[model samples]
Target: MNLYRIAKWVVSIIFYPLFRIHVIGKANVPKSGPVIICSNHISNFDPPVVGITSPRSIYFMAKGELFENPLLGKLLTSIQAFPVKRGMRDRNALRKGLQILKAGHTLGLFPEGTRSKTGELRKPLAGAGFFALRSNAAIVPCAIIGSYKPFRRLKVVYGEPIPMETIRESKTSPQDTANIIMEEIQKLLDLHK
Candidate 1:
């Protein structure tokens, strides 16, 4: 098997039992096509949880610093993660993400630029919306509840795909589109409470 799948298998094996990961609304994910999986970032574990829960293999946009360490960088790279410079414009990262979508692949990204220490949803970066608008890809809203800790029940809920039809119907700003996506994610979180 490919290294990406291999790593996913190994991590799923370990993570499933440790966290008791539970997923809902998984049927909302499209079977195939270029799609963007937009989610809230509460912890580092959020990415893997979303990626593993979805049936499609998702290429994640991760922070560049994670690739600083040689060994760790290689491992992350092998798993289909590309680095993005945080706290800046990061045009290169944006371009790479668009390219991934244009190629008809699944790209996973957290709209919240950074993890929330308090596990509360934060303002999201506009990049996810920009990607969806630019590539005309579907955005799958997802919510991950609870902290990423061992022996705890972690839940991930996927909302229906937000198609580009909404964006095409109007001249929506990236920030506005982002807010719409975040609203969907919030609704998913509310359902679990």
Candidate 2:
């Protein structure tokens, strides 16, 4: 009956068929809890793929440019996306993200900051780890395979949840934690190939 649920259904129903998305390891997703879905960015389509495939609402930090269309922006906001400066502090973006996580929901993040042109995994931006650490949310390292191509058979693999305690116990800085998550995502992609 609410707008967010309606928007989520519309997006998911429209996207899943067009993309032919294959979601694996969804069992790894906590049925109920705050989670950070740390992912490998491959294409512009990546965010929609993750959002539709998720069993729960997942928020992502979107580029400010995406909200240029007032109508589309309203729809995106309904499904849990908000704008943030791509490479700047963008305090508003950061606040929105943290607030989403703190409110006990999944917040999607591409640690790489942007898509990888070669479909190869890139070093994660420091934000992923920082947000997880700061929010104390479990990080679900996810890998989206073959999305670099338009309308391809995209596979999204969800690895085991990386506990916040493990991240802190490893004695790695937030940047290092982000890198570790990225590496784990890359390995998952390689495994499916």
Candidate 3:
């Protein structure tokens, strides 16, 4: 098995037992084709939670800092994570994201850009929507609740795929699309509560 699969199995085994993980709307994730998984950033645990919960392998645009450590960076890269410099245009990273989507892979993105220390959702950065619109990939808004604490029951809710056609027809700007994605995530949060 590949590193991604190995990591997924190991993480699934370790994490699920540590915390009660409840995954909802698994059917909402497309079985094939490119997809954008836009999730709320709660904690570092959020990535593994979402990654293992999904049925398919998901690639992530992780912060550049994580790639600074030689060994850890290699491990992360083996699991399909690329680095992105936060708080800048980071054109190279964006191009790599677009390439991933165009190649029909699921690209995971924390639209909020950084972890929310308070566990509350924040405004999304434009990159998520820009990639979604540019790559014409379906957007899946995922809300992860209560995973910030160890041994707490964690809930991951995946909302229905927002079609690329809908986004295109809306004629909204990239920033607006990002806002809409965040809004869907907020709705999922409300529903779960």
Q: Score each candidate by Cα lDDT.
A: 0.86, 0.81, 0.89
Structure candidate 3, residue pairs in collision: none
In model 3, the runs with Cα more than 4 Å from the true position are none
Task: Give all TM-scores, in the order shown.
Answer: 0.95, 0.89, 0.96
User: Highest lDDT: which candidate?
Assistant: 3
**Model 3 superposed RMSD (Cα):** 1.2
Overall local distance difference test of candidate 2: 0.81
Evaluate residue 102 in candidate 3 and report its C-alpha lDDT on the 0 to 100 scale. 93
Per-residue lDDT tens digits for candidate 3, residues 20-88, read 888999999999999999999988888888999987789998889999999999999999999999989
Residues 48-165 of candidate 1: C-alpha lDDT, one tens digit per residue? 8887888899999888998999898998888899999988889988898888888889999888888888877888888877887788687899998877678899998988998668
Enumerate residue pairs that collide in model 2.
Answer: 111-125
TM-score of 2: 0.89
**Residue 76, candidate 1: C-alpha displacement in angstroms:** 1.5
Measured with C-alpha atoms, the lDDT of residue 64 in candidate 1 is 93
**How large is the C-alpha RMSD of every model relative to the true structure?**
1.3, 2.1, 1.2
Q: Which stretches of candidate 1 lie over 4 Å from their true place?
A: none
